[model samples]
Target: MPDRKKIAVIVAGGSGLRMGSTIPKQFMEIGGKPVLHHTINAFRHAYPDIRIVLVIPEAHSAYIAPLLVSFDAPPSITIVHGGETRFHSVKNGLATITEPAVVFVHDGVRALISPELVRRCCEGALAKGNAIPAIEVKDSLREVDDEGNLAVDRSRFRIIQTPQTFLSEQLLPAFGQPYDPLFTDEASVAERFGAEIHLVEGEERNIKITRPLDLAIAEVLLATNK
Candidate 1:
């Protein structure tokens, strides 16, 4: 990749309503450290030289700023205020990168993302212009039509995960366009501008901590990994 700058934008825009906690889900702890801490650490472990942009709610940045100093190896991270929506939050992060590089857009609550998986995503993005982590759907799925619910082929569908990597040249420009309701993730946004998204295998443990049960599962998973 010729020493290209690798950057990761971790989006922590969730409130704790689903988790039923007073704190945001990302600020909650899984294995001693906060979920956002673990997430940022994963990227640092994968690529020590990578720059990180954390897009979080402006109100929460004060809570996280001091906490970052506690990291054994504090990373090159910049905190950006999150926008109204996920797409806008990502756009806020993307705006910081004016140089050509490889960028990864990740979910802050997806703290279980491993160093190995991060490497795979970066490598895939270096080869192809973009790489999105995804796993095939394992459960039976049904589609609703005018007739009624009908069985759908699960094999054709994939459960997408993040640390969605892309060449900044492609991504930065793609975000320049106006937002659309269908721009669910970086891949969708890139696709809107006719950029191809390549898929890489994602670990099952790379789950987002949205609910109370999810944090418990992540604790167990983190312990198992250790």
Candidate 2:
């Protein structure tokens, strides 16, 4: 087969409010390095030739510039101001991707995502048009009502994560639709456009850091991997 097209995007616009930190979760140090830096390095290690597009809050771009410089980030890396929500931020990142290559949309907090997982997602997207890394829900799930009452079946759920991959063409138009708070991720947006999304089994370690305790868990994983 011919070579697969190449592009990757990282969304890091989290305000850290949930984590109750003064700084954004992406900038928080994990095992002596920023979470976002580790996440980007994973991709670079996997695909050195892939162009990287990063989306961050507008105010933080200046702060991140020097970090990129110190790390000697790939020359192909480009930064864009992020939007208010994850969906919006991804849309902003998508706007900067000018090529028809396949793209992987990842969360910066998911610093443990393996290079192999990223490659798998990208390859799947190339063949299927849309792909997302997901894992079967092992815990008993419940749909709670507005009044905190259990409302649905527990066996029909799956916990989704990212490095959600897509063809640039398929994804570009999906983001053009009007924004909705209900739209959670790139995969959701694409699905709304009638894109067939394939699910790849994701690694258990591909966790998104949302709380202070999560940082501790991440550090343990990083140390074990090292």
The candidate maximizing TM-score is 1
Show the lowest summed lDDT stretch of 10 residues, model 1: 61-70
Taking the tens digit of each residue's C-alpha lDDT, what string does model 2 give over 58-158?
Answer: 88876585557647643567888887788888888888877678889999899999999988888788778878988877776566777785746656767
Per residue, candidate 1 scores C-alpha lDDT tens digits across 112-196 of 9999999999899989999999998999999998889999989999999999999998898899899898889999999989997
Clashing pairs counted in every model: 0, 0
What is the Cα-based lDDT of residue 169 in candidate 1? 89
Clashing pairs in 2: none
Q: How high is the lDDT of residue 168 in model 2? A: 85
| Each prediction's TM-score versus the true structure | 0.96, 0.91
After the best TM-score superposition of candidate 2, give how far the Cα of residue 120 lies from its true spot, in angstroms.
Answer: 0.8
* Cα error of candidate 1 at position 45, Å: 0.6
